[model samples]
Target: MSDFYIRLYKDSDYKVARQLFNSGNAKHTKKAFKHAMRQPHIWPPLLALLILPALDIVSFTTSIFAVVGAIVFLWFAAWRMYWSYVRLCFLDDMLDIRRYYLEQDGRCFWVAESGGQVVGTIAASPSSYPGGENHVELKRLSVSPSHRGKGIAKALCRTMIDFARHRGCKAVVLTTSLVQKDARKMYDKMGFRLTHNFYRPKPFTKLLDFKILFYQYDIPKLQ
Candidate 1:
């Protein structure tokens, strides 16, 4: 821990950051996928299988085709839901940190390095909150599993908060899944209040009941 320090992200850090994100996010994907299976997307197709029969909408041959279509719909929904989770969690804006966070004004991206090895990362970007341009949303907080409990994550988080304070931001916000109980706790311990708790991304997330919790740390309050 003495050797580790948090610093601005570099092009060279991109690969390791993406790798850490993928591996760290794999287990959560299962949780998200399971919740997705319970979404309305999957339910509609199943309901169609029952409704089409009750309505007697077709002849025997047509009914067979209808059943097949319903099955395909179910499969497609499952695949789509799972893929959405993957894209949302893995194919993130961190993939292009320069374009997404670095080049933009009031945005930042950083990585934690120890012995010249990037072991953790975090990023911040201006929030869209009305009249809150000074506010930032923290993103991509991750620590290498092999390096857990070494204080790298806490250090990275502190870096983001310090960066926000220097930037004159009002506060920093972040969102995490319910599956990330430890992360939520860490944020709480850091004085970030759970501002909102809900299933995010609207209709899709609503059906899955995929609970996402939002946290916010007031820079002035912390200081």
Candidate 2:
């Protein structure tokens, strides 16, 4: 069997990473939009109400107020929701692609062909803790769809764990949405246990309708 190699991400890998991200995004964006529109307070009835005023079928003043109210509500709601979705998408792209080339925190890795074709990637950064005890956070991990079912994610995760250990981290932590069942299963199999579940409503994570699961695993002492 040909061995797959993993290494640090390089500036040259950005193009392939972007291509992979766009392809994956195209597969899910429409469904995500539909899901967002179905939220109880999102798609309020506006056009049907607008006709009430034009036909003078009701008190004009009351109809005007109702129409204006609905328009304002929809505008504000859609503004909040769409921007949130955009931020979340940008956050993923930043962590997955841009940060690698920019070396934002100087911590990221890539898996690729020896001849230099990028196939998978994993990125991490030091945690925001003091006392020389760092918590490594896996920011992103992705494999080409064609490369799935070959243990790439597992190998990438193991590499990250080893890297964190080498850097003297006391523990490693990561968060994934409950919707990502396969990823949750993989993390569980890797000995990471769920530590918390909480809502993340930041503009950069709008599409994550459910609470996020935080997982943690203590680094074993080296013999």
Candidate 3:
């Protein structure tokens, strides 16, 4: 922790920061695929394939192929779902971090540097919701896998929170998914409260019970 420092993001940090973003998001896709496989509903279809062989409806070899194919399809579906979201992110604010965050008033991006490498990143912008005029949205937070557990993420988060405070924002808000267990725990420890959650309005997400969680940390207004 002593070796790392948090500072405003720079153009030079873009490449490494994008790598961290992709790596972090890739982990979520893997976790989501695993979670999808664990759902009770997923087993019934595979079980049916096995039962076909027992009932002599299909050869054992064909049943095996069907089960394996189903599993592969599920994996592919999960990957597609997650990466599609990532692509949209790339098309949006991430497409031009400077224009979206750095160039805008009351919004900024920060990175954690250690050994002259960017190990973590976080950004905050005025909330985009209809009635969130005083709120701030925390975005693009990622820490290098190798540098995690050393307080880099928490420190980056603190930087964003303090920035929002000084900017007179009412609260800091962030959204994380069910697969991001570590992030959920960290947010809880940092005094952010879980407000609500919802599953993406898609068949695959609904089937797997994949959910997105929203957390908020309200700042006390200055007297």
Candidate 4:
């Protein structure tokens, strides 16, 4: 059998991991939103207008008070929307790296090294619920753009699954957003099913246009 190595993340891998995550997120987000600008009715802006009424501090009984309140609310809303969008973009860029380096989980953090360089990572930890020994949570899994489609992610995932099984974890669960189609496909190929669909709306980022779906995977223990 060919030899490949996977291990826990180290402090030295932080910078490279951040770069990989940002680059991949940028590519994925752009590809997902390629047709966004072409839509006639921008959803974020419309939603902002609808919520203006609720922001009114003055009595809505008077026309003048209502109009002033609406104006003030819109100004703040627009500013918030712009800021939220910027933060969302930044968060998307840094998510994988952040989870890898900053997570408080203690089970394990696995990194795939090729030629002494970090190509991908998978982090897993035990479930927080009481008497949950038969389950583990795959928190964050990402592969560098340059090394994708080479089975790096799959190898890392399999390694984690095997480790979990050996530790008596009967199944593994993970969550990914709907925006990440490639990731969703990977999970499906690995036998994950769509267990839930939830909405995570961010109005402040001018991003009320999309909803994210959550996924779960139940991996059977090896015989």
- Top candidate, metric lDDT: 3
lDDT of 4 at 173: 73
- Give the true-structure RMSD of model 1: 5.1
How do all models score by TM-score?
A: 0.72, 0.64, 0.95, 0.62
Off by over 4 Å in 1: 33-92, 202-204, 221-223
Task: Answer with 2 or 4, whichever has the higher lDDT.
Answer: 2
How high is the CA lDDT of each candidate model? 0.75, 0.66, 0.89, 0.62
Clashing pairs in 2: 88-204
Q: For model 3, how does the per-residue alpha-carbon lDDT over 107-165 read when each residue is reduced to its tens digit?
A: 89999999989999999988885567789999999999889989999999999999999
Work out how many backbone clashes candidate 3 has: 0
Q: Candidate 2: which stretches are off by over 4 Å?
A: 22-106, 114-116, 129-133, 202-209
| Ten-residue region with minimum lDDT total, candidate 4 | 203-212
lDDT of 4 by residue, 1-223 (tens): 4344787777787777655544554454543343233345554454455565568733435545555575455445444543454456447534454463346543677788887888887777776534456678775577877778888888988988887777766677775555577888888898877766654455522332344455555666456
Stretches of model 3 off by over 4 angstroms after superposition: none
What are the per-residue Cα lDDT tens digits for candidate 2 across 87-157?
A: 57567645456454346663655555434577777767776434325788875577778777778789888
C-alpha positional error of residue 55 in candidate 3 after TM-score superposition, expressed in Å: 1.8
Ten contiguous residues with the weakest lDDT in model 2 = 24-33
